[model samples]
Target: MEDLDVVAWIQVSDGRMLAVRSRGRDLLYLPGGKREPGEDDWSALSREVREELDLELDEATFRELGVVRAPAHDQPRHAHVRMACFTAAYRGAMAATGEVDEYRYVGRRERHLLAPAAQAALDLADRHGLLA
Candidate 1:
């Protein structure tokens, strides 16, 4: 089985975390993407955020969030994925690039628009007093 390694940015602002929805995908996902070869977590996340949202990651404000491993929700069961998540500050306008069609800040809800892993990150953010 092939492995996919990615880094996600958990961005919280105004008591909500950022979530992105692709044009046809039902589930919202944290803003991130796959890492390039030889890139570390921070570098990969920075690149992804820039590519996806046209924003620059504030490295000085970055923090290491925990990682998540699960079967690739979009791929076959034989394909597993590992996510190295992080939190950072950004100072630019938001735009949907790559696969993202829309973006919004999500708060606590009985049902999340995001996937399980993204929901888990929201849970963590809530526990950290970052969510409404």
Candidate 2:
């Protein structure tokens, strides 16, 4: 089976978690992406957040929330995605960038709109009382 190892930023505010809808995509996803060659979790997550959300993640404040694995959304059954999630302070206003088309703050009630890995992250966050 093929596995996609990626990092994600989990930002929650006012009882809702940050999510993004990429261009040409139907489901919402957490704000992060695949690591580049030789990049570690912190660096990859920071870069992805900067590129996708136009925010600078404060690495010093980063905390590993949890890791979630699920079948790769829209991929073959043999494909899987392992998402390493982190939460941290950021330095700028959030805005859609790169391939992102829209941004939303979602709560448990909105889980059906999320991708598989994002849904897992949401469940974890809610179980840990991270979701307001």
Q: In every candidate, how many clashes are there?
A: 0, 0
Whole-model lDDT per candidate = 0.81, 0.91
Can you write out model 2's per-residue Cα lDDT over 1-132, one digit (the tens) per residue?
A: 778888999999997999999998889999998888999999999999999999999978999999999878865654889999999999998899999999999999999999999999998889879887
Model 1's lDDT to the true fold? 0.81
Compare the candidates by TM-score and give the number of the best one.
Answer: 2
lDDT of 1 by residue, 9-82 (tens): 99888888899986678888888878788988888889889888999989999998787776565656437667
Candidate 2: the clashing residue pairs are none
Off by over 4 Å in 2: 76-78
Residue 110 of model 2: what lDDT? 94
TM-score of 2: 0.95
Candidate 2 clashes: the total is 0
Cα TM-score per model = 0.87, 0.95
